[model samples]
Target: MFTKVMVANRGEIAIRVFRTLREMGIRSVAVYSDTDRDALFVAHADEAYSLGPGLAAETYLDVGKLIAIAREAGVEAVHPGYGFLAENAGFARALAEAGIVWIGPPPDAIDAMGSKVRSRALMDAAGVPIVPGVTEPVADVDAAREVAERIGYPVAVKASSGGGGKGFRVALTPEALPDAFEGAIREGERFFADGTVYLERYLPEPRHVEIQIVADDHGACVWLGERDCSVQRRHQKLVEETPSPVVSDDLRRRMGEASVRAATAVGYRSAGTIEYLVSGEEFFFLEMNTRIQVEHTVTEMVTGLDLVREQIRIAAGEPLSVAQDEVRPRGHAFECRINAEDAEQRFLPSPALITAYREPAGPGVRVDSGVRAGSQIPEIYDPMVAKLVVWDVDRESARRRMLRALDEYVIEGPATLIPFHRWLLRQEEFIAGGALHAELNRMADAPTPLPPADGAAPAQAAPGDEAPEPAPQAERHFTAEVNGRRFAVALRYDPPAGGGGAGAPVPAPKKRAKRSAGGAAGAGGATNEVVTPMQGTVLRTLVEVGQQVEAGAVICIVEAMKMENEVAAHQGGTVKELRVADGQGVAVGEVLAIVE
Candidate 1:
């Protein structure tokens, strides 16, 4: 076994790796960006190194810097934990050339599965079932349109080298193909540095299922059952559970065997997952993740296997510790990605200081987090704050335990998806194991509004008469900046009779300046402008000055927290001014372009 291993990641996954390394008597090393200097993972690791600024491209994704750090720290092996450079074959090769063991699958395996087009071909040749679509990369929108026409509508325009819901767009009709194709290519190049893309048949209501496989250099391979990751939003998984409610014993056996065969065909080793989209009893290959997944905890809870430990052992050239026949999964488990996002506002990223933090405890519950009180959720990386995993003897018990754990989990200073998870647990369809793709859209569009606060009630007034004031109360408290100086203020209001409050009401706080719905006024009138809906980088500007556009036309694309959002014009007009250019940083409500 290796004596020292450096985790090339951050947040919950880094802490997760550290815990397993400590148990195995291995000295864990952690690398952090400037913004993460005070992060919990840095404090917990046996050794830590600086990785420059918090920008991912300059810090975590810088392969050369990571290799140099590993050499300096005398790490025997490096574990690329699931993001950033985890799937980069070049980084793995670089680590190997530096005489350090890479605690992941071989670079050759990552290379083989790095591109979706090539992986589709490889899987087909290996006799693995795959979706019906073009296996070759399509160049430009015209070529994409032809391919989509051939494959039929509702096709997925996907980046050849994309994962985790990035670089993918769906074209449900012939008219939508152009935008989807261009958007896919631009996002592919921006996120993965690869512009190659392909077409695939979109599965309308398939359950997302995957088989976890671990292999060793000595040719011993074992398939660790399966996980159902169907609970998703915008193609990103929000909830994952082991032993899918829809997957039968016979189907599980078949899928496990197929996964083993697929791994063996690619000469794969270490821990990996082969994802599939299953509808009814039929299943098709989605793609392979070349590292430990975020939801691996549920598998560990049910199977009692440490996937990271297995990965390290495999990288050390050890044979499989457990054989296929010996592997037995015993209970149902659930995992919810506790992200710092507002579930009511389309799951927008909510980065702020964590004033208070608490994790749930007791039997069948585990929390993997890297933040505590005073931890700031930076906007540079993923919004996932922690992972909540729970286990029980059966699915029902596991569901109930998850609900209880969610209720007990407390966090402040940022909006989280806690309410959404709680609501999902109580849904009848979710409990019945129904696929949630369509239902999720409906929920996001019109979520149930939260109830009023305790003791709060609507005020009733008599017709035509001035409402009588009952009492004065402070309704809201916040801080504001005046002329570059900050001051705390409270919003006060007088309530009618029967309201519970005492004393005279103080004046309300001054209101902040509000930007006009339109942009800067032109000579004719106020120019209608398209503004960014969130803080992010401008990925592209789709409109130019003097260009005539219609209402709802997309004018630009803004990427926030790694998710791309289209900024569209509000009304039909001619483009008057372009305020921002590509690659520029923008704040929420900042005007991007003006249309007159």
Candidate 2:
């Protein structure tokens, strides 16, 4: 076993890897950006070093800087936690060239499965079941149109080097194909620096299911089982569960075998997941995630396997200890990604300083979190604050345990998906395990009003009359300046009191609704709040107390990623007060506005 390993990432996953390393009596090193200087993982590591600024391009994604840190720390191996440079094949090769063990799959395996277009062809040659789609990159819009016509409308345009839903778009008709193709190309170019894209048959309402596979250098491999990740927004998984209620034992075995074949074809080692889309009994290949997944907690809860430790063992030239039959799943397990987002608005990011934080604790309840009470959720990275996972003898028991855990999980200074999760657990579709990828979309499209909170006080319309149809209490908005031009941003927020249960109509700019106040009352219905749209510094606030203004007026400017963004008013009202000033640091949804 290696004496020390440097975590080539930050946040919760880094801390998670550190915990496993500590348990194994291995020293751990943490790398951080300037913004994450005071991060919990940094404090927990036996050694630490600065990567660069908060900018991803200069920090986590900087492979050269990361290798330098590894060498300076004198670590025997480096573990690239999920995200950042985790799946970068070139980085893994560089690590090997530097004579440091890369605690992941071999570089060639990563390369083979790195590109979706290539991987699909490879999987087809290996006789693995794959989604029926184009085999080559689209040459032009003409080729895409031809493929779309043959495949029928509602086709998916995906980037050749895309994952995590970036550089992906869906076109429902020929007329929308041009826009979708262009959007996909633009995102691919910007994010992946590879404008190559391909077409796939779009499964509008398919369930997102995937299998976890772990292998060793000695050619031993096992499928830990499968997970259903149907609950998602914007193609990103929000909730996951093990032993999918929809997947039969026969189908699970078949999928597990297929996953093994896919890995073996590439000589894959370490931990990876083979994702698929399921519709009824038919399953189609989606893509392969070549790293430990954010949803791995649910699998670990059910299988009693430490995937990280297994990854280390595999890297240390040890054979996998468990066999296919020995890999038995105990019970149903569920994981809800506790992101710093509000479910009431639009699942907008809600990064802020957690004034108070408390994770649920008990048997069968596990929380893999990186933040504490004083931790600030930096906007430079993903908004996922933690993952709340629970296990039970059955799905119902697991659902109940998840609800209990969510209720017990306390967070202050930012709105979260806790309320929405609580409401979802009580819904008929979720309870019956009938949720699909389109479920959230259906709820979002519903034309109903959100119900009031259980103990929320009624709103006083205009500060005098008895609450005339309680409007939603103060919600937050975030802003990110893309260029020197201060573009008005529509920050993400959650739904109202009912969460996504009652199916409220998507909010419109001109629509006025009454919201009941949840806590203390304020003058003219103002509570003195201002929130950042993107992770950046507060450049200036243009509003003052008793300032009369119309709706859509600029109130402040936030400098994020070197761009200036203007914060605007949601309603035509007077500014009651300003919570922050010029040059003050802020995060997403820090409560910047209090208008009457």
The per-model lDDT (C-alpha) reads: 0.81, 0.77
Model 1, residue 256: distance off in Å is 0.7
lDDT of 2: 0.77
Q: Which ten residues in a row have the lowest lDDT in candidate 1?
A: 497-506
Give the Cα RMSD of candidate 1.
8.6
Best by lDDT: 1
- Tens digits of per-residue lDDT, candidate 2, 1-596, equal 89999999888899999999999999999988999998888998999999867588899899889889899889999999998889999999999999899999988888888899999999989878777788789978999999999988789999999888777899998999997898788668866788999999898778889999999978688999999998887677888999898998888888899999999999999999999988887788888989999999989998899999999989999888789889878989999887765554435455567766778999899988888888887655777888899999999999999988976777665556676677677766787896644446533322122323332222324632233322223333345677666664433344443221111112222233322222111122233343444456676677788898664556776654333445666545677868888778875457777887
For model 1, how does the per-residue alpha-carbon lDDT over 112-146 read when each residue is reduced to its tens digit? 88889999999999888999998899978888888
